[model samples]
Target: MGASRLLVSGIACLIDFDDAALSGPPASAVPTVRSGVDLLIEDGRIVEVGAGLPAGTAEVIDASDRVVLPGFVDTHRHLWLTALRALTTETDLGGYLESVAGRLGPRFTPDDLRASAYFGALECLDAGVTTVQDYAHAMRSPDHADAAVSALEASGIRAVFGYGFPVFSTARDLVDIRRVRERYFPADDGSLLTMALSPMGPSYSPIESVREDWKLARELALPIAVHVGAGPVAQRPIATLEREGLLTAGTVYVHANSLPDEELRLIASSGGSVAIAPAVEAQMGHGAPMIGRLRAAGIGYGLGVDVVTATAGDMFTLMRAALVTGYLGAGSRPSPADVLRAATLGGAEVLGLAGRIGSLRAGKRADLVLLRADAPNLLPLHHDPVGTVVSSAHPGNVDTVIVDGRVVKRDGALVAGSLPAAREALLAAAHRIAG
Candidate 1:
């Protein structure tokens, strides 16, 4: 463990509120934003937050001219596809499937997977995203899974490695999933890494296959993440899952864009959550993002960068997309505070890690981001700090990022891991695979 650190003189958004806060009318919730606040962190957890705390042998980080908040949580991401960025920007879902899944996926080696995962994780950290649920769907072999997990461990970012079923395979077995669990994540030890099962849901798989996949997830006692309402399928996914007795809690439904209100209600009643990738959904023709519907259904939802291959992998872009799409598509205009909560605490709830890493409470893990409030684009530091973050902030405004009591990006540059080496390796792999 390192020395204790104190963050002083910053505007802080605690996001510490009950579920009823979101269910009630807008701005009806208790105020969580504060000014001239300080946070004390030690042993990888927040120790306290108040007006003025004594700095007892701690390193004092001046947070003046900054807006400090809980670091962003990305609920869904295909991190292994980072090297293939912009390859499918002009394509729809089918074209993405053809180019990424059919063409480039098969060409990846374990080294390539490691390079992509490490670089992708670092990119998220640089953008002040402290946590991510990496949907590792490109796992062609057990070696591939191991490579991705090791890269995440080395990157120092909090992550849930969603061990995915092998894509484009007829067998679609869970043999390697069990192996990975026993090897990398034997228990819920307090490490930054955890495991989840990413299986093709009822929409993309046969009932038998879905049954087997769900069985394996239960056997491992892991949470599930699956794609729903992503493309044309034979059956209504949520209804079919309910009918089959497989709609379980702690499951995150990704991209429920085309699902009806009743289906979203099913998710909420069943204690499930949704992960919306607004940028990818709008660009790839999945459907209008289901932000308004999700809010009306009272379902907890989080934003995601589904694939860097199609959109910018930053929460700033994602938040703005969610806001504009919420207005244009469903006539539900979410305030900047609402979107910020979704990006942070709401995302933590979706991943079932709320108790551990969501807010800036005294007991939670110390995952924090400090944005430059004095930046030219964010000047004036208006009365609504969260509004500035949601509307004007970008990755370039990320002045510092700390995850689990470790400073990863400080002074607007990444300080953890070997970024230069990771970049070279990723470029080399991209050349070999995409060429």
Candidate 2:
């Protein structure tokens, strides 16, 4: 499908956003859920959303029994780890570091990075995640980093390619941001593909190296994402960052399981965001999940499928896990709307792209997911749309997916060709790396 005029008609439910909704927190405006509406798009942007819109020459998509929503934005994911699926199932984070990152990561070639990134991104798109932050941390060389970027571009998923620098790398391993940015992300305005600097966090890197990396990212005006609150050594990371004047709204702290209350408050005050990968955090023993604490602090947070090696890399699993954990910890159930928002709009805000692709609003990019509400597991419609989405719908219920006004998945199948071949290539890469 071309990026021309398109109309999605007869949507059973539409989770649309208004200016007021984006003006405050996720729950502030209470997302406007409308029934039986049509959305019009042109040039890869939503132009009109309401009832009774004319469908002229535009390609018409029938969504009578489907739910239309902003495509999910996954705030954090190590895409290059998909080849090592379930490799860390029984291991803790420390074990993972020793076994995977220490042993196998350095052995990977540029071809391996390319294969894993391409496969990981397609998995997300097929599962209804249209945008993701590919935290490509295995950049053994500049060629390896370029391979990761090339794979993401080929996959057609909207992404922020996070260039993860290796710890204690020589000066030759450092990224030439100006040169690479010009080659891949030249516009410097807003494009589907953006860039971020993912550095070794304060807990791992020497403070001097951390300062240098932070300064480089800030000078480039790019967002920074780092792992935080994994254990005692990382307690109150925001304070250290604040002392160095490195904390800002562009920073996205991942995991952040059990920081001090004052530190959590400091993050919110400093306009920083958090990305919680609840399933992986709970399974990998990264303290308790921080969804409740983040909410209590009024800090913006979004869901992340941290690693495919340990968890199901999909939004449904992430959302359900977050809700269950939040309830178990806080002794109160979080609103379904809030959870959905975390997976979609909240994730966008954390990535600093909320104004562009978070919700079904006019002038926003046409990244959307259509789920079959009439599917067997999702049958017996409920009164609440958000509740239905959170509790009942699974990735299998995804009927169609659109990114940038292009119909990438139609009738539950990917429009892109040769996915089986890609899977075979991934299997080969995984086998070689494992050996």
Candidate 3:
């Protein structure tokens, strides 16, 4: 846990909205940007945010010439593939599956899983992503699952660890899932770690297996994260779920690149959300990014770094991809404000964590990022902070990052763990697995 700290005298872009406004579309919620404001955090929660707040006993951190905002939330990411960065840059969807899932994924040891997950979480923290939905689908054993969870806890990032079934496994039973659930994530105890069920949906699994997985998720009351519209399954996945009466709230559909408008409407009607990885979809030929389609259907969607194997693993790159592809596909560019909202609050909403970690308001977790306004790429932050962030900013400009009232990255470097050790471990594991 981190000590109480006061961030003062900065330009803060609070992507805040009243809890009553939760029923409205996420795009309709406006942000409140203010200058020379102060935020007081105590006991891992924001206590007050306004002008001339009393610092009292808290350590005052000078946020002078910085742009303070809520930390980025990555809605969907395969953390286990971090060591395989750039391996799929020139591959299509089938190529990716054949190379990674079919070849390398089966060779990972528990130690390798720990190294990849820990380094991946650290990379995210260094890039100012405080919260991430780790769609872990590479579990080979219960030991592998334990290693991944332990690595996330040791890295100090707020994560929803989606307990996924193995990619190539044929067993459809819940024995392993039940064991992991009971051992690691029995309930939502307000810790930094939570759990979700990442199953191969109808597109990849049979109807009977999908039904059993959904039933197990409901029995445990955990959220569901599944892939839809990516593979070449003939039957419509959403329609199949609806026919089986398995569509429910708190489900995060990943890579809905090929899903039609009717399925988008069904997701919105069912109170579900989406996690879009624009760069990956374009590179891997999953299809076009669904920003415009999600907006047209009035569904809330969050941007993600699907896999570092195909694209850069940062929110800034994903934001830029989302902006350009949105314009190219829809013929209308989305505003920078809307895109930034999707990176912060919209991502939180997708992960079912808006109430605790999305916006920088009173009574929310103190997960914040401070960007250096003096960086060459972001110089003269002239009257448009959100635009600068969405258009020009990168990971190098992230000066400080705080998660749960704890400062993880300070002075442009990660401070929570030994990154050099993590890097060496990752390299060793990568070489071993590649061989």
Best model number under TM-score: 3
Tens digits of per-residue lDDT for model 3, 310-332: 99999999999988888766423
lDDT of 2 by residue, 275-343 (tens): 989888888888776867777787888899989889999999889988888776642356777778889
Off by over 4 Å in 3: 9-20, 27-29
Poorest 10 consecutive residues of model 3 by lDDT?
Answer: 9-18
RMSD over all Cα atoms, model 1: 2.1
TM-score of each: 0.95, 0.95, 0.96
Ranking by lDDT: 3, 1, 2
Q: Point out where model 2 deviates above 4 Å.
A: 17-19, 23-29, 167-172, 230-234, 330-332
> What local lDDT does model 3 show for residue 87?
94
Candidate 1: segments with Cα more than 4 A from true spot: 1-31
RMSD of each: 2.1, 2.0, 1.7
lDDT of each: 0.84, 0.83, 0.85
The better-scoring model by lDDT among 1 and 2 is 1
Better of 2 and 3 by lDDT: 3
Model 3, residue 428: displacement in angstroms?
0.4
